[model samples]
Target: MITEQKPLHSGYGPESTAQEIVSDQDLRGKTAIVTGGHGGIGLETTRALVGAGATVIVGARSVDRAREILASLPNVEVIRLDLMDPNSVEAFAKAFMNSGRALDLLILNAGVSFPPELKDARGFDTHFATNYLGHFQLTLRLWEALKRSGNARVVALSSIGHMIGPIDFDDLHFNKRPYDKNISYGESKTACSLFAVELDRRGQEYGVRAFAVHPGAILSGLVRHLSNEDLAEWGVTRNVDGTYTSSGGFKTVEQGAATSVWCAVSPMLNGMGGVYCEDCDIAEVVSADSQLQYGVRPWAIDPTSAKKLWDISVELLNIQKDTIPNVGTNLDSDRLLNVSIEEPVVNGQLSFTR
Candidate 1:
């Protein structure tokens, strides 16, 4: 089992913001990519990272809007990337690779939630497609760049919703089971945690690491599909006072972005990977009925499950086993120039996993 320990940066809590966590840290030469960087906690994360001297690439489906929002930021660029579209994901990865820039931080922050029943071109449910598969393909496509960085870190934005249930592998796409929007969202988030654990196990020897984060509850564009009635039903908003209620412990956008920035830039987490984190710290393990305060669940941190998820993902994505690069293999400087690249294929269909 991976050790459950606190992060080295000791002073922050659930209320800390991105700026506070990154204080005094200098990312002068680092390169970062944050999906959904145009709004909400994602935007705040970009702002904080850029302010600290990192060159950030903002990925969004709408390039014009993303560019406009990031116009005044130095060393920042916006690229068109729609996680829901396989072709678009491929194009984005190709563009980044062609630039030959190594990435120091990669945050899988873009996701859709609780949408009406729909599936991608590949027939995977929409929530799973965008929230898990899209990021999965993007990470694989950029694996070479990540390995080249020599200390790259990948962060997937998971959520407390994962506590609702473990992944139902047999019916991952809700093909056989009746669909519940909340359950679908939880499954995707659970996949996020599984991905992080597996990625770390596969890449740690190459100086690359991965982490999964639950950014706490916040009102963001992620809730756009929900109406006031839906919000009330979820207890996220109240009708009497017109105020939002805590699904668990509600946080501000900045606070929600704190753990993300910390995972990206903090030297404190230097040698650690594959852990689920929250509130700017490596979360403690908590009971299922433990009020959802802070920390990871046993299922989220289970290595056996994580590896199984990886194998299942490789099979589902039709990624060849031989193509799965050996983790931690020492590479000569020259070999680093030509890292392995895998083509994403799902049963002869060119489909991108979210």
Candidate 2:
């Protein structure tokens, strides 16, 4: 029950770009996994990491689209991963592990926001499954690779939206109550934060660290479900040319990627394990009644709640303590991941878990 919350004032802020964060660092020989690395801030994060000489692996649903964005980037590999499908998540993890590479940085950067009311094949909320559950499973499956890396970091892409979440454990799947898309999205981010808190506690002993990051709002495809008017409702602006013009104060994608890059490679955070970060620095705890949009909420970083979420996730996946196999020492790169997910979500049926 010890606290791992607090800000260190490392001196970076909203204006910092990913390029600035890694200006003084070197990631040569390092290997990283960035989910959704081909899109939005995730793309910028990939650029930063690989620019520093890291070999970056991405779990992408559309390998073609991923290649289209990153074909020119060296040391970048794309594998099939549909975050909405548990089977694809497992295959991606298996493929990555089978490569026999030690994972130095794992950025769980893939996420969805503000989608229409939808449920997974398991009947779990689509936002929750895609944003939280899939990442949780992938991280667990890759735990050994991280530990083998000797000093690894896992950054979970959480958000300020977590402020609206107070997990309804009894009705987590929105089974009993009417569903609210925003609330479900918030709940998913909250789960991401809690996962990092608890994962850090467990993995710190193994030289692996975890962090939850709030990449500032940007007009990424994360909001494709919204229209121009819907975007305006949330302070996002779109131009007539089908591109974002401005967002009340949304950061550029490069700026949006700064905190992740900072958390991944900055020496200032060497001793830190679990913390919620925003604007390129550790965030301060805010009171529930506070009017400010910044700062981390106590509930989002609560250790008790973190443990509860961990247990729930473990149970949902039917994973036993020994389920994580030890395979980081030897990889069979000759094997291939079956890329058979023609449609990740089809006919309102989700087949995420076997």
Number of the top TM-score candidate: 2
lDDT of each: 0.79, 0.81
Judged by lDDT against the true structure, how good is candidate 2?
0.81
Model 2 lDDT, residue 138, Cα = 84
Extract clashing residue pairs from model 1. 132-354, 133-353, 133-354, 134-353, 134-354, 135-354, 205-328
lDDT of 2 at 237: 75
Count of backbone clashes, every candidate in sequence: 7, 2
lDDT of 2 at 292: 78
Query: Cα RMSD to native, each candidate?
Result: 5.1, 4.5
Ten-residue stretch with the least lDDT total in model 2: 345-354
Model 2 C-alpha lDDT per residue in residues 1-354, reported as the tens digit of each score: 333467777888899999999888789999999998988898999999999889999877777879998999999999878776767776788788888889999999987787778876677788788889989878877877898899999999999998896688998988898988889988989999998888888878777888999988777667766777878877777667667766468888899999999999999888686899999888989997666789888888888999899888877766654453222233222222223424343243222110
**Candidate 1 C-alpha lDDT tens digits along 146-252:** 99899999999998888877889899999899999989998898889989998998888888899999898887556656777888765676546554564665678
For each candidate, give its TM-score against the true structure: 0.87, 0.90
lDDT of 1 at 26: 92
TM-score for model 2?
Answer: 0.90
